[model samples]
Structure formats: structure tokens, C-alpha cells
Target chain A: MSDELYFKPLTELAALLDTKKISSVELTRSVIARTKAVDARVRAFNSYDEADALAQADESDRRRAAGKARGPLDGIPVGFKDVIAVAGQPLTASSKMLANFVSPYDATVTQKLKHAGAVVWGRLNLDEFAMGSSTENSAFRATCNPWDLARVPGGSSGGSAASLAAGEAIATLGSDTGGSIRQPAALCGVVGLKPTYGLVSRYGLIAFASSLDQIGPFTRTVEDAAVMLGGIAGHDPLDSTSYETKIPDYRGELKKRKGPWRLGIPKEYFGEGLDPEVGAAVENAIAFYRERGCEIKEVSLPHTDYGVGVYYIIATAECSSNLARYDGIRYGHRSKEARDIIDLYFKSRAEGFGAEVKRRIILGTYVLSSGYYDAFYLRAQKVRTLIRQDFLNAYREVDAILTPTSPTPAFKQGEKSDPLAMYLCDVYTIGVNLAGLPGISVPCGFSSGGLPIGLQLIGQPFQEAELLAIAHAYEQGHDWGERHPKL
Target chain B: MSAPADLNIDHVANLARIALTPEEKAKFARQLGEVLHHIEQLRKVDVTGVEPTAHAFPVYNVWGEDVARPGLAVEAALQNAPAQRDNMIVVPKVVE
Candidate 1:
């Protein structure tokens, strides 16, 4: 019972816990044991404290016993991407800079999850400072795809998606800048959702790209994703960018908002680069929707070709500004060889950052510099407007847009050595982030090689409820998500 | 707009306050040059009257009421600092 308990979905575990069939401690221990057993091969965690997790689980069981159960999430163990702050826990961001730094306070999402009675589990690894498409950029170690250990787990949220797929965590939290959550989720065969920008607070998330970054969930099922979203989504004064709106019961809305809705297929997404198997899987998903009486239209988003180009400029510029805080003075890594204050800044950053990080910083700095600012940065922003306008214009005709979450299934580790080649991995998913709309990646099918493929649904800003329902309509009928990798 | 020549790595790295090795400098210049060349296509977009969007959803002048809130304890705040003395971060001397 304990052995198989690790792979059970959050909703199922919740019911068992409520019926007193299983205690939180028992479930947490099973997950811990599973993690300890499989983590050597998968390498999903940055750090986990078994005693701390069990203590939280014990407290949760005590609450439920005392007739004060918080909610469905109570006693559920959930892992967090290392970028999200967990008070007194190591917050490494998979970077050597913060390798020893501990978070001083809880991120808003962390506080909210704790309030929902979640047993915060462990710090999951990621690409260093959430910069790369593959977790190979991690200063610590690379996370392997559980399905095929030789393949890469699509990243910067590779650990979040891999752990959930490996059944080491029931549900996990991850941050998405450009397809980080969705791509990894697609590769790992799980449900990953990126809520509309500003819908979820970004208060304590280690900044990657301020305008593009969002915190979201990776769950085995759409229903679990909805539950996790409800626990973490809300406005907070702590994040001024956090939007204020009615927090609807997302799970309840799943049953209430049934849709035989109009879905658009952006032709640009299905073009040349998409793998044939992944493309066929998405086409079948569209056919499923059409057969169910939902209208499927081919909508053209003309500016789609420029998404990656525009994203690199805007995201890098924002990251450069946000990352300047790590100057080796107040906190984080400080170099011991510095002779002066200025030299300290230079030497520390040089020593602390990885190759990918330094390359981005230089690129970001060049784009934002005086002479090139208008030519590069400002022009990119203008093109960004056109890219966003393309999406808003498409929404005028359709309820949501459908596409493959990733172009191909998970590629082999270290397959994409060139920087430009790695950047192209996000072609299908970057547009959603550029437009700041809600998007979700649900398991559509598997590649012939037995690797998973994801179908992405893009919805209007603040329309995550409708988006989840659309994805759920197909997910409910399919058994693709039911299959697990043999570890 | 014409694409610029290879990036001046030393100048940009200095601006970013990072000291890169000679190998990194050469490699990054070539890589970033290709990326920049691709970005030059953005110049073709006609922006006659288009406004640049710094944020996807722009909010302006967010006002918060003057209220006292508990802050991180000094110990907690300084826990990760590399060097500290008497509740203050210790940095290299700016003055002789």
C-alpha cells in the first residue's frame, strides 16, 4: 500500500486521507521513500529534508484528527521549483550564486499552499536561474526524462515535471517564462498550466524575466491542476503586478462550464519544424473536438515567426535588470579574490554565473546599451506589440487556440549544443508568454518511440477557467495520461 | 537597419560587471552575433504609430495605503549575507 501510494493523484489521496484510510505521514513517507529510491537515476531534486516533510505531515494529520481539516490540499505533499522561496529552505535557482543561500521568507504561493494545509516537500532542480531549455544548464545536475532516461526533460522546470511524472510528488509548482512549465510537462506526460500573467503573485519567485514570468502547477491530471491553481491563485499587495479579481472555485467551474466551443488552430504552429508524430496527435485532438460539435478553424497569426526573436530581447533585458541585485555584497556568493569594490562586483559575478548565464547577461547588456537601445530593445518591444496584437485579433474569432506544446518529443541529452538551436525548442510555446495569456499543456498522445507529446490550449487573458475546461473535455475521454513510465 | 559587426564583448561585459575569460569572450561574440542578426528582422516591422509595450498588461501608479507591517527580522535578513557586522552588510571600503 505504501509503495503504490506515491503515484496516486492528489484528489485520490485527499479522499483516502479524509476517510481515515491513510494518514498524511504514511503518504508523505511513501513519497519520500520513492524519491530516495528513484532520485539517483532521475536527479529531480536540489534538496529535500525528510524529517521536515514528516513533521509537516504529522501536523497536518493532527489538524484532520482534530476536525479542522483545511481543504482538499491538506496533508498533500507538493514539491516546488527551487526558484520559489520556501522559508528556511535552500533556494538555489540551480545556480552556484545562491547554492548556499536560504530563503528568509515564504513566497506568496508558499504561504498560500501552507494555508491550504500542504506539506511543502522539497526544492526541485531547474536550469540555472531558469535560463535554459534543458536542465543540463543546472550548476548541480541535469534532470533526466523519467520515460527515457537518455532523453532530456524539457526545462527550465524539468525537475518539477520529471518528479511529478516519476511519482515522487503528487503535484508540483513551477515558474514559466517561455514554455518552461509547459514544455517540460509535455515531455514528461503531465498537466502543466501557465495562468494569465499577473493572475498569480510573483512576489518571492526569483526573478527571471519580470514581464514574462508566471508561477503555475504540474499535475498528473487536469482536475488536480485546477485544485492546485485555486490554492495558489489570488492578488496580494506583496506583488503590485498581481491583478485583483474574483477568485472563482476553479474545480467547481470545471463541472459548471461545459463547452462545445470554437477552437482555432494557428497555422504557424503546425508548419515545418513540428515532428510528424506530435503533429498527428494534435490533429487527432482537434478532430476529437470537431466530432464533439465544437467548431475548429484555421486561424493565421502572421507575426508568429518573430516570437523567438522578440522574446530574446525583452526577456533578456528584463533578466539583466532583475539579476543585477546579486552583486556579492548583501547576500549570495561573494568572491574572495576581489581587491576593490568594483572588482568585487566583477570577480564575484564572473565566478558565480555559469556559461549560459554570462552569455545572456552580455547579450542583454548589449541590447539595452545607449547606442543600440532604440535599434534593438525598442524595436523588439514594438514587434512584441504586433505579436500580442496577432493573438488578441485571433481571439475575436475563436474561444481559444490549439497547438502542439512542443515541436518534438523530448530530444536526447546534449543534442542541442548550439545556443540558437536550443532557443528554437520554444517556438510553439513562446507566443503565449509574449501575449501574456493563459496556456495549458495536456498530454495528447505518445511518440512512436513511447515518448509523450502535449497539446497546448491558449485562452484569453484571465480566462484560465474556460481554458482548463476545454483541455479537460478531451483529457476526460483519453487514456493517454493514465499511462506511466516504467522506472 | 543594417546589422552591426560582431559584438564588442569587453565593453558589454564591463557594463554588466562580469569578467569573462578570453575563450568565453570569443565564443559569446560569435553566438550573440547570430542572435542579433536574427533580431535585425524586427527593424522591418513598420511602427509608424505603434506604441511599444513594456508590459503585456500595463498598470500605472499603484497606490498602497500607509500601513505598518512586520518585516523580516534582522537575523533572518542577514542569514545569507557573505559578510556582516552589527546588523549591517560588510562591503569593500569605498573610501581609503
Candidate 2:
């Protein structure tokens, strides 16, 4: 009923729904309207389904009125990154290879959200096969940053982060491989979580890098992130890698959160490449936490320097294998008039994959090939073990680690044309994924250029509840979340 | 590291099943060298006697229950393929 519905926190929305101050249908309608108003300029969503969203919201309203409670995400309108399957809907990954592809069943994450009574608002855009750091690699139109359309929203989950930043959707699901979730979240000035590997099921989500990919939520606030995470964070029989640990009440603990928490600052994070403005903002965040009675200790993660190299090998190798199924067989994208099966394979992939994707796939296949595996892929995996050990040792002495999420603020679109240049932007983030630890990017401050800077918090595997509590406390202590883009 | 020209762009292209123009091969050779050089930084670290782990954490095997589950129908499976013939996807002859 109020304009505040788009800006209200998820917990507040849930409370209003519980007290019937705003009907589920009304909330869904309002969000749908906001999305229509803003998305034309933002290009955040690849597919918008107002009829389905309203129908689901009506169902949620009926359930609530009948006193049949589902979960915390009840009546919330959330968006799905296009790569994720949404049952009987398209799952294109924004690639021509899957242009007409429709999923037969919901992905595991989608099933969980639906079970929690959340309305599936629409499908947000993403880079093709989640390949690039910027959504510019998308075979579809690029997703613009809400703050400044000329600058990029960090990518491949660019649209997911942009949608949340523009208030088009209260929350959206994003898949992080490398820094897909964190980078975009930082660029768009939103809260994005990259849950520890296997913490959430990847069964229904399209594979980017099987080992590196983890689906998480992007929201405007820390509390909203916790609430949305609660709905989708548990074991699923269909996804073998799903967590077996108990799903804690993240929202509840965050509400009563008090901190004397130990925050680790890895010396490796504040190194040569970090921009001055970004570095100052992170230091300020650490000082803010120190004032909140949280202990700050400088820690070492020696293998941090090798994180990008190791992750690239492991991720690309897995991508080569995972994407092998798309060789003009089974489903999606087949080349016509091929001389034979092999030519069909060649032509299909040649026509299907974009430049960045081709580069990774080639590198991956080369590393995993016979005679090269021991030298490249095997060596990278060995280093990956060392990277994980670095985190294990650091966590023994700290509750969570804080660092700058990216080396620099959002660069102008096309500034990083060289693939390696783009890859370096993930230097701060790759280490966490290689260690299989949970990480979140929270807006810390704005650069002198008015672009946002993000501070990352890395937690041990399955420790999202503690992570959220710390982030919630930090959000309250600082006025960062109060800031919004001038779009 | 191999010379930029000696990087076997053709061999890599064959393995990746991508057709590349000569210009593309030359261009990618330089790009791949740059990336490989960046990757060579990992070689500086001492990883002697360390056990290799493909997964970040230890897990014997992560798998779902082996049960027959409903899948998309045959028609649905081939719906998106650009070229299909006789209820099967048509591709170039695989055997040389």
C-alpha cells in the first residue's frame, strides 16, 4: 500500500504479511510494477512473467489466510538468473546454444523457493554459460548498472545484482563461479552471498564450473539475504552434493545478534593491486567492526596469490567436461548439413560458444588431455588443496575474514577487453571459492567517483548463520545499506 | 613456455572441436601465451609431497540415489536441436 514496500527489508515484509498489513498479492503486484518501470532501462530480466507471479502470489495469500504457513519467504517475489531451471520455463543461460531450451522440471533451488511460498517473478539475464566477468559477454543484451548505466554491473550474475540494486526485485538468485555473485554485487551495490560449495544443491542449476559454482541470493540488505537463504539452504535428495547439516534460523539469530567476533584480515588481500579508495573503505569497515568489540587480527593465506591460476584450471577443466554433453547431440544447438558426426560436433560448438567460453574450454580440454593432465590439471588441483588448507589454518584463529571484495571499483564498460585483465579482477574472490568457504560482499562505502566499494566476509563451510549475524551487526553499525543508487 | 607461433593453435583447436580462421589462431596464440604466463606463477610455489585434491574438501563420493526418475520425453529432448533426423540428433560422422 505504501511506496516503502519496494524499499522495506525482507523481515519487515514478512512481518507485514504475517499481520496482514500488505496482502501477498499486493506485494507481488507492487514489485511487478517496479520491475516494469525500471527494467526497461536496466535490462535486468530476460524473461518477465507477471501472470505467473500474480497467480503464485494469490495462492500464497490463500495459504496465509487459511493459516497454512509455509516458510519465511512466503509471498516474496524473487527473480532467478536465466541459467537456473524454473520448471516448464526457459533455461537459456542467455546463450544461442540454448535459445529455445525449456526445462522439463524445476531446479533444486527453485523447488525449495516454491516450497517456501515465494513467487517466481521472472528470469534475470546473465552472461552466456556464466563465462565472463562482465555481462557484456552475454549473447543477449548487456545488463546495465543501476548507479551509472555507462559503467558495468559486475558480471556474469550482473542482472541479478542489478535487479536487486534497482529495487526491481527484493531478492534474486545468483550463481557464483569465480566472482560472478560477489563482483556484480559490488558493482551494483547490493548484498550477494556465495554459499560454501555443496551448501546448496547445484542439481537444477546449469553447470558453469561444477566444483566452483554455488547458487546464492542477492538482496538489498543483510537481513534479507539471511531470510532468502533460509528458504533455499538445505539438503535435497536430488542433488547429492547438497548439505547434510541443519539449516539454522538465520533471521532469528541475526535479530538477537551481538558480537565480540574475531575478524581476520589476510595480508594477501590488501596487496599491490587493490585501489586506494577500495582499500580505505575496507580499512574503515574493519575499524567499524573493531569499535563494535570485534577483534581484528592480521592473518596470512600464502597460497592466495595462486588462487586465480588454480581456480581457472579446475573450473575450466570441469567446464570442458560439463559442457561436453552439448556436442550436437542429446539436446540444444545442433549444426545442419555436417559431413559426419565429428564435423557436426565441430560446427555446433564453433557456432555455439562465444570467445571467452571457447578460450576456457580449449584451455580446459588441453589440461585434462592425456599426457598433459599430470602437468597441468593435476598440478592445479594440488595447489587447490594448499589453498583450502590456508583457509583451514586461518579459520582456526578467527571467526571470519574481512577483505576488499574487488581490487577496484566498477570499471567503464569495455575497459577490460583482454581476458587476463578481466580475470585479475577476481583476485580477491577466487581464494574463497577454492577453499570452499562461504563469502558475502557487503557495500562498505562509495569511491570518490561515486561508485560503490564492497567489503567481503569469508566464513568456514556451513557457518552461514554466524556469517549473517556478523554482517547484520555490521550493517546496523554502519549506514551503508541506507544508501541507494540514483537511477 | 613455447614460442607464440609454436603454441599448437591447430592442435588445441582440434581438441576443442572449434574451427578457427588462421587470423584467429594467430591472435589466440598470443592471448593463450599471456594466460599461460600468468598461470606459470603457480609453479613458483613449493608443493612437494602434497596430496592432490580435485575437490576443495574431502568427500568419498557425492552422488544422488541411483533411481529411475522421470525425464523429458523424446520429442521434448530434441525440440531445441537445430538439426535432428529420424528421432535422433544428426552430427558429422565421428569415425575418421
**Where is model 2 more than 4 Å wrong at Cα?**
B1-6, B61-69, B74-78, B81-96
lDDT of 1 at A479: 82
Model 1, A124-206: lDDT tens digits are 99999999887989999999999999998989999999999998999999999999999999999999999999999999999
- Candidate 1 chain A weakest ten by summed lDDT: A1-10
TM-score of chain B of each: 0.89, 0.74
- State how far residue A455 of model 1 sits from its true place (Å): 0.4
- Considering summed lDDT, which 10 consecutive residues are worst modelled in model 2 chain A? A1-10
Task: Please report, in order, the local distance difference test score of every candidate based on alpha carbons.
Answer: 0.93, 0.85
Q: What is each candidate's DockQ, to 2 decimals?
A: 0.82, 0.58
In model 2, how large is the Cα lDDT of residue A433? 84
Number of the top-ranking candidate, with lDDT as the measure: 1
Fnat per model, in the order shown: 0.83, 0.63
